[model samples]
Target: MTLEELFAPFGLKAPPLRVLGLTLDSRRVEPGYVFVAVPGVPLPHRKPLDGHDFIPEALAKGAIAVVGERELSLPVPYLRVGDARGALAHLARHFFGEPDRKLALLGITGSKGKSTTASLLHHLLQAGEKPAALLSTVGLRLGKEARPNIGHFTTPEAPEVYGFLREAVERGLEAAVLEVSSHALALKRVEGLSYRIGVFVSFYPDDHLDLHGTAEAYFATKALLVERSHLAVLNTRLPHLKRLLPRPHLLFGPGGEVWGEGLREGEEGLRFTLHTPWGSGEAFLPMLGRYNLDNALAASAAALAYGLSLEKVLQGLATFRGVPGRMEVVQKKPFRVVIDFAHTGKSLEEALKTLRATTRGRLLLVVGAAGERDPRRREDIGRVAARLADKTFFTEEDHRTEDLQAILEALAKAAGEEGGLYEIIPDRKEAIFRALSEAREGDTVLLAGKGHERTLERGTLALPWDEKAVALEGLTALGLGGGEHP
Candidate 1:
């Protein structure tokens, strides 16, 4: 397509240039490609490599035109935009033919519950005869494609994000439930796409200082989704929900528009009363914790808003198997092994508190910290693990470009200073094995972090690994791998 055709979506006149494809990264530029240069938000005294530096490289690669920030001198056609990221989103939509318009789009945003809620919402919609697609930290699964796209980041780049959505639409998917991250909102990835229903889960302050610089900025990023969504489903349980003042929104919680009351925690999952706009019904989730009740309510609201009846939605909820790694059970051997993706202090506390209620024996928690993002959470996570877990095993969780031992030392110091019971093991697999080896019948071993992750990343190596699979191997060795406790 010509550059004019590509820029049509942005309401800008296309330059006299032919472009074969579009990209923001200069490395991916090729002949007939339009490169978009987006200036990164500088962090305090530090500054990011400006997109202008790559304009020359992109042009050298035969890029016909460049959509970039102001102050650039290039021989090729260039269009200056006040917000380059927003322009990229708009251009990509037009270039991809606005694929999301053809597919049902559900946007979920919050500090937590986005991934799990998106996964569950997709499951429920598909169960109700709505062929659905999902894009989340867990991975993208559309039609028969199940392998996660290559990346450690929760949300991919704008082009990749739109590419995945376009692929889902091409596969004839009727619905796409996406986990909209704060970074994606701040970067304007969802700037142009229209969501049929937007669900605002709950929020907690974590992993934002580096990008957003402050808690208020993080909160504002989340609010953008609520403001733009056609039907906003807010979690009334959030402590700051009042401050958000979500418009065109229906509140949900333990006693709100969509809720799960009378919750009864169980050994495997929790059974609760699910209340929705249509009617209230008793619902049983094969997943643990009160947080999951909120997740279910959030998904229930989205499904209902998308036109599924309360009966179909509740039926879907009843039959929906939980997402892997989110309160997922790995084994029920001589002991029970539960694998969860709880990395935050609040998440760990909730997981441990929930498990402590059901476990007959010692509650063991194996957790680790992800390097490079939020260093502040290291000690906090360790402290929480020590306070709640009877036995805490600390291991490495994706220490990309960071020293694993150094990271572990930080956590160990925090945990030790707090009088927490914990041990440091740099290898996550070894930590899991050690936790399992220490477990006895009736004991509950909770493997926190790397819940449904299929790969164990270490430096440049990504080895195939699954917590559920490893725990099952141990359970089978113990002769208790057939089924759950009867």
Candidate 2:
């Protein structure tokens, strides 16, 4: 498609201009392609060599044209847009042949549970015989085939997001479940894509404080997804959920559209009595926490909204084993070992509380704060571990450029009450082993962060690592628990 044809729908009046492909990254720009200069978060409107300096580099790199906000003194055809990111999303839709036009799309966005909910919805729909695909932090999954999404951006680059959807459509996926993020929504990554249903699992005011500046802005950005959808599945029980989405929506509660009551947590998983509008059933999810119940309910609403049979929905929900890293139980030796991706304060508290509810013995939690994220939540995460966990071990979680020990110290300070139960372990492998070695038969060890991530990144190295594998190895070495794995 030509550049003129791509932006024609967005009211860009231009003479015919040849275009082969589209990309925002200069390194990936090729001949006959338009290079979109996105105003990055850190250096807005500034090119690499210097502000206004890298236009020559981009031009020299075979970029036929450039699309950016600032006026460039380039000889090639350059188009300016009010917001480059928004324009990119719109152009991506056009470039990808508007794949959503032929498929059903569902978007789930929140501070937490987005991954689990999207996965759950995809699994449920697939079990009901609907062709489904899932896009989330975990990766893109089309049926049983999973692919690593190296796109660091949660929403991914707009072009890449649309490209994934195009692939899904080409693969004959009937339904697509996208895990939307606040940054993605704010940047209009999901723009031009129609969603049949939207699910708001729950929201917390941590992570991405740098992007949104304030909680209200963060929430308002996320609400854009719900507003754009045909129907919204919401947890009316949450104050933030109600406040952000004030419109009349499908409520999931006790006896609501999809409700969970009589929730009991145990070593096996969470046993919750589900009461839906269709009928009542009990689900034994191999996941912990009341928050996860909300995830299941949100997923159930998505399934029902897709017009599945009641029996299918219940069966799907009942048979769902668990999502990797979202409160996944790894070792059940003398004690229980859980590996979860609970990095946020709210998630940490919820995981601990769920463990407390079901654990017959003590709770030993190993947690860490991610480097270069919302630093404010670091201390709060520690405090949550301190308050709820019997033993808390703080370590480094993807430090990036930040000091690992500094991160641990901040976590330690926030763990005001957990001083005695806390220890700083810089090495993650040792941290896991130490936790396992200390755990007794009845105790539960919770390994937080890096749940399903197959790689553990330390500095410039990304070594192969899996939490469940490490936990099992530790358990085997300790001669404790045994269970089945796929």
Candidate 3:
């Protein structure tokens, strides 16, 4: 493609020159590349990262032209625009041949359950003999296999997003399921793409408040996906969304278009009778926990809206081994060990409550909150753990460059307020081992946060770590099993 063709659609004039590729990151720039110095607000720093700062790196890396919000004297061609991110999205869409036009997109968004719902929906669609692809917090899946995702962004930047969609089209994928985040929508990472079905999972008032400034703004940004989609699938539990989005949609909770009845949790997982607009049928999930029922119902609703059979959806549910680190069962013998990605207050409470009820003896928890985000979440989770579990281990969880002790103190104070039994362990691996060592027969141990994640951040250093592997290591130390990862 040529520079004229890429920028002309966005009303920017540039010299006609061959453009090999498009990228926002200067490190990825190559010969004849159009580097988008997209100034972004990914963090809450007083001095935000401006793409203009990376111009020299892009030039040194052989970037043919620079597209950014700032105007500066450059060695090569430069185009200044009001919104560099939006322009990057549009130019990528143009260069990628508008791949979304071919692939049917089902966008699942909210603070939580996005990755699970997207995975479930992709599974259901493929069960119906349709080609599907997925982009989620867990990673990218072209088919049944997944590639480990890089970085912490749930939704990656526009260049990668469009490039993936372009690849999905090239692979002849008929559908794509994406886990959209509030930051992605607000920052225009998903710009210029319309969804066939926009799904809204449950929301928490305390999630990502650091970025949205208010719960109202955060909720509004999530609703943006529904604004552009042809159909909106929402949870009836969140009735306020109906008022915010006045458009017609499929509600998936009690008294809604999709509902689950006779829910049962067992050794085999969860089983229930699922009701959808199309029809009702018996459903079985290979994953445990009642909280997953909501994820199942949400995915079923989107699949039904997408014209899949009820039988196919149920089959997909039954065959799904469940997403990694999502209530994953690491060991089940004298004591049970579970690894989950429950970092938020609501998720932590639900997970603890579920395990607490099933525990024949004590319920022990290994949980911590992330850094550089809301502190109120840590307080809420701490209190919840105190009330739900017999004992809690307060430990490290991605305290990136922030005061780790302050974060732990917030949790410890909340636990103390609830009169909860707890211990402060700064080292995450040590905390996990301590929690495991304390578990007795008939007890259940939960390793929460940092689920399925390959890295653990400590003072800006992303140390290589795996929660499941660490849990197994702890189990082996207890003389129960070997350290080999199952």
Which number leads on lDDT?
Answer: 3
| Candidate 1 residue 131 C-alpha distance from true site, Å | 2.5
Residues 1-486 of candidate 1 have per-residue lDDT tens digits of 678777665676867577678888898999999899988667542446677778889889988888887876678777889888888888887777788788878899888888889988988888888888888888888853676744656777777778888988888888888888888888887777667778888877665667888887888888877777777888886656776563567778856778777888776666887777788888877777867888888998888878888888878877877777888766665677888988878788898998888788999988998766678878788889878888888998887667899889988898888888888887887788788888888899999988878777787687788788787776666566685742
The Cα RMSD in angstroms, rounded to one decimal, for candidate 2 relative to the true structure is: 3.5
> lDDT per model, in order?
0.80, 0.78, 0.87
For candidate 2, the per-residue lDDT at 230 reads 84
| Residue range 353-387, candidate 3, lDDT tens digits | 87776789999999989988777888898999899
Give the top-scoring candidate (TM-score).
Answer: 3
Q: Of the candidates numbered 2 and 3, which has the greater TM-score value?
A: 3
The residue pairs that clash in candidate 2, if any, are 333-480, 333-481, 334-441
Output the worst ten-in-a-row residue range by lDDT, candidate 1. Answer: 40-49
Give me the runs in candidate 1 sitting further than 4 Å from their true place: 8-20, 26-32, 41-65, 70-80, 143-150, 239-246, 454-465, 469-486
For each candidate, what TM-score against the reference?
Answer: 0.89, 0.88, 0.94
Question: Which residue segments of model 2 deviate by more than 4 Å?
Answer: 7-20, 30-33, 42-57, 240-248, 360-362, 416-418, 454-465, 472-486
RMSD in Å for model 1: 3.2
